[model samples]
Target chain A: MPVIEVNQLHKRYRDQVAVHDVSFSVEEGEIFGVLGRNGAGKTTTVECIEGLRSPDGGSISVLGLHPARDRAELRRVLGIQLQASELPDKLRVAEAIELYASFYPSPADPRELLERWGLGAKRNTAFGNLSGGQKQRLSIALALVGNPRVAILDELTTGLDPQARRDAWESIEQIRRGGVTVVLVTHFMEEAERLCDRIAVIDAGRVVALDTPAGLVAGLIGGQRLRFRPSIPFEDAVLTQLAEVESVRRSGPHVEVTGGGDLLHAVTSALARHQVVPGDLRLEQATLDDAFVALTGPAAEN
Target chain B: MNETASATRTMARAPQRRAPRPFRALAVAETRLFLRDPVTVLLAIALPSVILAGLGAVPALREPADVFGGIRFVDYFAPSLLAINIAVLGLQNLPTGLATYREKGVLRRLSATPMNPSAVLVVQLVINLVTVAVGTVLMLAVAVYAFDVPAPRHPVGFVLTFLLGTSAVFAIGLVIAAVAPRARIAAGIGTVAFMLTQFFAGVYLPKYLLPEVVVRIGEFVPPGIGAFQGAWTGDGPAPLQLAAMAVIAVVATAVAARFFRWE
Candidate 1:
């Protein structure tokens, strides 16, 4: 069974609709990504699922429990790392994990959790004294202390440096490997692409697309761009006349080919027939970044 | 990474697993944090007693005075010191602590746990109440033992008055905690309230010297000094004053319940 199911979820702050219509299901152990822009309502949706906010419309079932009515039960089993939640400045790292552990019926041992999360050395460190990456890791560790079946992490790496972001990605993958379902809410497409098993792209309070990283790129803006320098002079029609070639353009000594449907094999065979060696050849496909922009549209800039 | 998963799995499937008590853990953790702030503890626990000792040191205050119902000023002022502690803590200490928790997202994070976020505030209230009780007792003991001030003649009245006044004043503080959008604002408002509360309670000056209108108006407001003072004096806890305290407690607590937000 899906660990979390949010159907036609709707929420509003006053008259402003924060989540217009959102729907998805998190599989038992997959990293499900909720990809969206800043105001695209990803946080609102997850907050509702975490029982922090109630949806104005539609129903949400987390571990087969209603988020609103079964809030107490759901909280016991669903670990949540909120976007801007923070601990007291004086709270020590180990104290925090141990305190959260007390809230669960059966929780991971704080000492073991600290060691595994690489926070054993900083166990006595105050929250304010910790570095940014350490704080993030600590929060993630706290979320997992409950030994929850599902964990929802929002804006996981918004302000971290690149190195910290990489480290966080590894932690997330590790969490998934522990048999916990993960819901990752983030505006950073790179994060979703690298870590998420399947991403639901939310745009302006709606799920615009839902698929794996490569699937999102392929389904939304599916195509390949081939760039190469030919060893010998060749006619443009030799590539353009073929079915896979959409257009042919020459920039300096390089011929760029844009097409789909096994274009690499088709173009390579055509070049071989003409006795032209394709040197410095590179094939480029649209990334999740491009897919996000294409799906969210230009309005996301505002 | 493999170590991380294996460690987590092992801990999860460990034998002898049982739930840790949340309330005790939160209380212990909260007390540790409270003790870390030496300045706040000093102000909350020691300031009242120090002020009482200062008043007791006044030689003229030991003399019987008609202005203070023919009793020595030390006797009357000593009991009212408890009221002062209540106001300072309720108006300044409690509200700031709770609002800071909300502003810092501590309350919200706790809400995400199985334990309700309001449980933290409850624990906080208990801690503050206990602190005031212990601090005020110490303050009173020093004055009684050192300055020869008599102990409260009405023990039942003293305890009742303290609980009533604390509930009323802390309820008012709850209003500030409920409404303030930020921690600094809550502290700012609480400080202003504290000043106003002290004025009515006659902290800046003795009540006999204050204007009739100020005293009359102060009777109806929080920390209701009359009830608090009466409890400490030989004969006090006037029925009218007790009723007033009860009303404030009920109404303010209701308002706090309606308006309080976790985040």
Candidate 2:
């Protein structure tokens, strides 16, 4: 059975609709990505699933239990790391972990979890005294301590440095390998592309596209792109004569060739034959970020 | 697989047995944090005690014999001091602390876990109650031994009045925390409210000494009526006024729950 099933979920705040008919299901042991710009209803949808906010319409089930109706049961099975959530200023890192663990029916040992997250050295430090990265790590450790069947993390690597972000990514992968399902909500394209098993791009409070990163990139805008700074200025007629040259565009000092299959050989052979070797010849593949921009247009601005 | 499943089940059931520990831990955590800051601890406990002691020292501060019926100023002011201490902890201290918690997103983190918002609030109230209890015991000890004030004629009545009055004021603090735009604004409002209650509610001076207009206005305020009639007195106020105070406490609590912002 799917670990989470959200069907036709709608949430309205006053006159504004925050989530409109959003429907998706997360498979067990899968890293499901909910990608969206700010105000795209990602947080609202997840909050509904976590039973923090009541949905105005439709239904949500986590681990075969209704979220709002079986809130306690849902809380028992699922853990959440909310965006911008905080602990009391005076609460120590170890105390915060212990405090959260006390709420669960079966929680990981606080000391063990802290040590595993490399927070043991700073365990005595008050939450307010910790640096931003340390705070984020502690928050993640709290979410994992419950040993929940499913973990929901919102904007996981938002404010972390590159090294810290990479460490967090490894930690998430470790959790997923331990048979825990993950639902990640993030606006960072690189984060989504690197960690997500399958991503649902949300736009204007709706799911605009959903697919694996490679599939989305492939489906949105064909295949490989051949870009080069042509050694000699070529006319449109010369570019069209090359095989596998589906489309060509000139911007400033370079020429961009877009197409599929054997394009590299065709372009290189054409260049050699004309004695026109490009200064910088590079092959570029369509990325998730490109697909996101293409599908949502400018409205998906993060 | 079956053995692993059984192990998982056992692990899951373990936490249920230890659920209450977290609530106690949280309360202890709050108490430690509250007492860690010397300034705040002083403001919470010593401020009311000092004010009460200072007021009791003045001979002319005593109420007329007709009103208090030969009661000493210390006897009259001691119970009110107890109530004032509770009010400060609940009405002023709690609101500001909760508002800062909300402002800093502390409560939001607690909410995301299995901890209910009500649980957090209960822990805070419990800590405040403990502090108030300690302050009351110390204040009463000084009143009896040093000031030679009479013991409460109706101890049960005094305790009930103190609990109800504190709950009412605490409820007001919760409402202010819930509705205030920011922590700084909540602190400002709490300070202003504290001063207003101290001045108008007869905690600092008897309502009879105030202008006729102020006395009339004091009748409508809960703290004023609570201090006047709920504290140790010859006969206390009418049963109807006590019932009104109880109702106010309940309604204020309900309103606070309605508007409470978890984030």
Candidate 3:
């Protein structure tokens, strides 16, 4: 059974509709990503799931409990790492573990959990003195220390350097291997692609698309995009004339052709017929980045 | 797509287990933090006592005076110093600590855990109470033993007044922590309140020197030194003074609980 089910969830503050018609379900033991740009209601959606925010409309069932009405029950089973949440600066690593552990009826063993998360040696280190990556790892450890059945981690790597981000991803994968379901909310496409089993793309407070990483990329227009600067400039129609080509557009100093089956071969053939050799020859397939843009659109970023 | 971002209210949710273990754990952690910074702890808990000792060192204050009703000036000032001790913690330390937690999202973070957000606050209160208790003891020892300021004649009344005064002033501190948007602002407001409490406690000038109306008015103010003095001299534990402390304690605590912000 799905561990979290959000249906037609809605929330607003004053007059601003923060989340409207949002819906998704997270299955047990999966890292489900809620992907979106800034202000897309990704955080709001997950906050509602975590029982931190009450929804204005629609029902949410998390582990068969209502998020708002059954909050205490939901809290026992659901762990949350809020975006920008912080610990007391002077709190030592081991002390933090002890404090957070006391919150649960049956918490994970602090010593083992610390060792597993690579914080065993740094047990005496204060939170303020930890490196960015260590802080992120500690946050994840705190989320799972409760032995919760499900954990919601929001923007976990927003500020970490690339290496730290990769390290955090490993920690998350390890958590998933331990049989805990995860709801990962993030804006970084690469993060979602690397860690999420399935992603729900939210745009302007609505779910634009929901699919696996590859599926999202594959499902985008024509499944492939070809970008090249012609050796000799030619009419945009040269590629547009092909049966497989759907849209022919120009990106400065190059032409972009997007289409379905056999698009790469068809475009190359058409370019050859025009006596034009492609410079900076690059055959582009879809990426989650491309999928995000196609789904959310460049205009949506503003 | 503007996010409807605002601070989340830490709503009281489902029945919580009446467990003392979590509270103890948090209290230990808070105590560790308190001790970790010795400068702040010493200044908050020991400064007033040191100031009292300094006053006792002055020869003029050591001599019994007419206005003091046969009590030494140092002895008259010592009990008010106790009130000042409570005032410092409530006005300066507690508000700054709680407001910093709120500003840094510590309270908000605790809300997400299985931990009730109120636990964070209660633990702080518990830890500060320990500090205040320790500070109270150390100051009294210095007053009675070090300075030979004879112990308060009505010890029970003195202790009761101390407790009530602590409640009243700390409630005011809580109100500062609750409404202050930033930690620095909380500190600023706390300092101003601390100064006012000092003025009323006659720390800057002896009551014999102050105007008659000012003395009467200071009796009604929080950490009311008049009440503390009345209890110490064995003549009066004025009912009206006790009532004022009780009223401030109940009203300010309720206001603080109602208006506190988690983030």
Candidate 4:
């Protein structure tokens, strides 16, 4: 059975209609990513799972307990890191950790967690004094302090520098290693691709696609492009003669071949028959970024 | 792509037990935060005694006055200053602190955890009460030692009236905190409420010398009758004043609880 299940969830804030129809289930230990554009109801959906917001229509079960009805029980097993949420300005990092830890039955050692997250030196620092990256790390640390089975992190790496983003990803990988199921809500295609085991692409409050990172890239637009500079000039039509080649273009000394499935082998055999040596051969394929743009289009502008 | 690398790294999930009482931890943290707030400490803890010292320095205030039944002016002002301390802490400090916490997302963050966000509200009230108690003690010490204003003759009555009066004002402050959308709005509402309550408590003028109509209005208010006048008379606690405070406490607490927002 899945650790978390959100089926046909519908939430409306007055007349805004934040979430129309969204459904997905997270298996016991996989990192599930909710990918969407701003205002795509990613946060709203995650909030419902966290028991922070109630759904207008649909059922949500986390660890076999209803999110709203069994909120108190569910809270014992699930941790949450909300987007744009913060601690008191004067609250020290150590104090924040201790206070959160106290709320749970048994929490991880705050000192060890801080050290693992690279925040040990900031134990005595006030929240307002920490840099953005440090603050994000602290927020993540507080989320895991409860030693919960599952954790939902909303926009965890937003506003972080590139290095910090990578560091956070490493911490998340470690958290999963600690046997915690993670539900990550984010818009960054690179982060989702790097961290998510499977991703659900949400656009306009609807699930447009749900698949593994590589599967998503392939399922959306399946193709490959081969770029090369021919050692010697040959008839361009010779390359196009191959049935696998979809399109061929030659710019100056460089030739570009675009096609899908076994196009590389067919073109290479054709090139050898024509007594041509391919120079600077390079293969380019679609990435999640491309898939994301293809799925969300104008709505994905961030 | 790194699925194999992660598969080898999975650690066993351990069954963990619940910790000891956590509310006390939160309460201690709140107390530390409350101590750090210079605005609250200055207005609620230090200013009351400072005002009392200022009053003691004036020769006219030390002279006996017929309006106060031949009691010295400084003696008459003592209990009123203590009432002002409670009023400032409740009508101003409590609401401003709570609203700022809500605006900063502290309460919202707590709600997502195992801890109830209302714990923060309760902790803040507890911390504010401790601060007011300290301020009350300091006022009493200064009045007896420095100004020679006699301590409350009716000790049990004084303590009961003080508790009821503080509850009434704190409940009203909770309502303000619950209704105000932001910290600045809470501050504005608190200030207006504080000013009105202070007026009724006779901060600007002697209560006995006030016009009969104004005195009658003050009699029905908690800060005026239950806190200040009750403290000064040190006589039998008036049943009407105690009933007024009880009604305010019950009704305001209900309103605050009904409307309070974690976000």
Candidate 4: RMSD over Cα atoms? 4.5
Model 4, span A1-302: residue lDDT tens: 99999999999999899999999999988999999988999999999988899999999999999988998999888988888888888999999998898898878877778888889999999999999889988998999999889999999997788988899999899889978999999999999999999999998889999999988876653366899999998986897777777788888889999876677788899999989999999988878888888898865333
Candidate 3 lDDT over residue span A124-188, tens digit each: 99999998778877887888878889999998887688876787889889888989999999998
Off by over 4 Å in 1: A220-222, A231-237, A241-243, A274-276, A298-302, B1-13
Docking class of 4: medium
Encode model 2's per-residue lDDT on B1-263: one tens digit a residue: 99799768866765554544667777767777887776866767676567767876787754446555576666655654554676677777888888888887777777777777677778788788777777777777677666667565557766666666666778888888889968899888887777776665666676547787875665445553444344455565445545655787899889988998877
DockQ of 4: 0.58
TM-score of each: 0.94, 0.85, 0.88, 0.90
Query: Lowest summed lDDT over 10 consecutive residues: which window, candidate 3 chain A?
Result: A293-302
DockQ-based ranking: 1, 4, 2, 3
Task: Give Cα distance to truth, residue B113, candidate 4, Å.
Answer: 1.1
The C-alpha lDDT values of all candidates are: 0.86, 0.78, 0.85, 0.85
Error of 3 at A277 (Å): 14
Top candidate by DockQ: 1
Q: Taking the true A–B contacts (Cα pairs closer than 8 Å), what share appears in each candidate?
A: 0.87, 0.70, 0.70, 0.84
Better of 2 and 3 by DockQ: 2
Q: How is the predicted docking of candidate 2 categorized under the CAPRI scheme?
A: medium
| Worst 10-residue lDDT window, candidate 1 chain B | B11-20
Q: Write the per-residue lDDT of candidate 1 for residues B1-263, one digit (tens) a residue.
A: 99899967875666456656998999999989988988888888888788877877888998998888898888767765666778778888899999999998999999888988878898889888888888878887887798777777788887887788788999999999999999999999999998888888877777888899998877666778877676677577787887888899999889988999888
Residue B127 in model 3: lDDT: 73
- For candidate 2 chain B, which ten residues in a row score worst on lDDT? B223-232
